[model samples]
Target: MDVRPAAEADHASILAIVAPILAAGETYAIDRDLDETAVHEYWFGPTHEVFVAVSDGAILGTYYLMANQRGGGAHVANCGYMTSSSALGKGVARAMCLDSLDRARQRGYRAMQFNHVVSTNTRAVKLWQSLGFEIVGTLPKAFNHPVHGYVDSYVMFRAL
Candidate 1:
């Protein structure tokens, strides 16, 4: 798999990966009916550094890294990742995360944070933990999962 910075032409593929996840309303805290324009703005806006994981000329996963906050908190990085349903369990998400860590370090970030990891997404929670991120805080009933109703969310972090 090749993970690299996303080019403008990759926008369509990125949308393909995000659409189902967003529509499911199971993990990310986003509107289920968000249009392509809004999705584009959120994922590929000027503030984000977006990347794609490609294998055999197909995009299988993607991620975006940015400052968790401005000014005083700029040293901490925040990221969002998504893998195509077909690529799950194939280590695509894990690879993208490792790449993000390296990218964050290269950009001088001192830490990496995931502000709202859905607790019910056990796979992600475990992956992040295994990758050295700790669950520093939990927000009870923070996410309204489509299948699970209200669920807790976690704030995960790790120093770079």
Candidate 2:
């Protein structure tokens, strides 16, 4: 598989992967009924940088990275990752994550932080831990998981 910076031509596939993930309301805080235009603005917008993993000309996963905050906080980066349902367990997310970290360091970020990671998403939590990210804080009932009622959200971080 090849991992490269995303272009406008990849937006459709990016949306295809992101739509269901957001609509499922099980992970990200995105609106359940988010429109295509808004999704485009959020995922492929000018403010952030996005990358995709492709194999055999099909995009299997994607990730976006951007400054977590402005001014003094900009040195720390934030990221979001998504993989096609059919692509799970194939190391797509892991590859994308490693790429993000390398990119963050190359861009001069001192650290990376995930502000809200749903506790029930054990796979992601474990993956982050394995990659050296620590659970810095847990906010009680920070995420209202659709199937699991209220669940704690973790703030995960790792220094570059």
Candidate 3:
């Protein structure tokens, strides 16, 4: 798979990859009913940098990286990732994440943080851990999972 910076032209395919994940409301904290305009602004807004992973000209996954906070806390990077359901378990997400981390370090970020990783998304949680991110804290009843009801969230971080 090839991972590269995203262009406006990739928006449609990115949406196609992200839509099902958002609709599931199981992993990310975003509104399941989130609209395209909002997603566009959030993903491609001025402060964020987005990337896409492709295989044979098909967008299999995408990720967005941005400052974790403003001012003093801005040295850290924050990211969100999504892989097309059809592309799951194929290492597309992992490749995208590795590329994002490299980009984050190149952008001068000192650390990378994931503010709200759903605890029940075991695959993702484990993957993050394997990638060297530590689960620093747990926010009890933080995510209202669609099927699992209230679930915990993990604050994961890793030094660049």
lDDT values for all models: 0.96, 0.94, 0.90
- lDDT string, candidate 2, 82-108, tens digits: 999999999999999999999999999
Clashing pairs in 3: none
> What residue pairs are clashing in model 2?
none
The global Cα lDDT (0 to 1) of model 1 is 0.96
After TM-score superposition, the amount by which residue 69's alpha carbon in candidate 2 deviates from its true location, in angstroms, is 0.8
For all candidates, what are the clash counts? 0, 0, 0
List where candidate 2 sits over 4 angstroms from the true fold.
Answer: none
TM-score of each: 0.98, 0.98, 0.96
Minimum summed lDDT over a 10-residue window in model 2 is located at 38-47
Could you tell me which residue pairs clash in candidate 1?
Answer: none
- Residue-level lDDT of model 3, residues 24-126, one tens digit each, is 8898887888788776666677887889999999999999999999999999999999988888899987898899899999999999999999999999998
TM-score of 2: 0.98
